[model samples]
Target: MIRIVLADDQAVVRDGLSMLLGAADDLDVVATASDGSAAVDAVVRWTPDVALVDLRMPGLDGAQVTAEVGRQAPDVRVLILTTYADDDAVLPALRAGAAGYLTKDTTGEALCSAIRTVAAGGSVLDAAVQQRLVALVGPPVPAPEPDIPDGLTTREVDTLRLVAQGLSNQQVATRLVVSEATVKTHVNHLISKLAVDGRPALVAWAWRHGVVH
Candidate 1:
């Protein structure tokens, strides 16, 4: 089962999430916290596989809790479950080590899938969140020369560009007229060539290097 800790200041939200996630046969709501500090404490105490954290709380915010978890329990993946998908809210949590993010409007099944994905060392950004992120990140400031990574094939660069635009592998495949497996292979290659962690990191690199602008 995927062990989880839920942190949200609103009691109703906490309870609703608890019931919703608990109903999933493969998920266990191991603990719940009402504030950021408590969320960190619960994560440290329970060492759950995933922590569902809110963006705003009294003692510590989502970004703070994510940072604390990264420091105190690096193995525990954090998934930001928040109402806000604004760039200001999403970027910090992600930079602070959150593995995935989802708006509260996410369907119950999709939320569970996100939790499982995070626990399995994958990252997810809600479609809305992804769009907000790109808009917020904005077009990169033009440099004298684009800092393209060396040794990347043209196809890999094309894949990277699509990924930077927040397209999923399937979408990228369709756009490129390639198989999904081919897109995945190109993504893996780009990740290695860029020396980044995952899709998020790859997107960050693309933004920094003006690859997507």
Candidate 2:
């Protein structure tokens, strides 16, 4: 079974998620937290496969909890399940090493699938969240932008575009009609070539360089 820790400030939200996720045969709702600190504590104690966390919690907030979990329990994956889908909220958590981001409006099946995906070391972003990411990245600039970074081939550029759009490696592979390993290779190469830390940083670089308007 896939172990999970659900964290939300609302008691009702936690209860609802517990009930919903608990009913799944392959999932176990190991524990629940009403705040970010407690969420990190639970993760450290339980070392669950995934921690479904909220963005707006007292004490630490989602990004703080994500970073803490990364420090204390690096093997555990964090998947943001929150009401906020804006870039301000999403980007920080992603930079903190969150495996995925999803809004509260996602269906139960999608949420479970996302948790499983994260457990399997895959990233996820809700369609609404992806749209907001693209729309809120930055103000549009004029065309004929700066030159592309050196050593990024055409395929790598395509992969980077999809990554900035919040697509997972598997999704990018499907979109490019290539293998997932190939997509990961492109991502790693771009991260090295662009000098960014991770996917969130890559997205920020894309905006700054006019790669994604």
lDDT of 1 by residue, 11-127 (tens): 999999999999999999999999999999999999999999999899999999999999999999999988877748678788798888899889999999888877876578887
**Residue pairs of candidate 1 with colliding backbone atoms:** none
Provide backbone clash counts, one per model: 0, 0
Query: Which window of ten consecutive residues has the lowest lDDT sum in model 1?
Result: 131-140
Best by lDDT: 1
Candidate 2 CA-lDDT value: 0.85
Q: Best by TM-score, which number? A: 2
Task: For each candidate in turn, give its C-alpha RMSD to the true structure in angstroms.
Answer: 4.1, 2.6
What TM-score would you give candidate 1 relative to the actual structure? 0.78
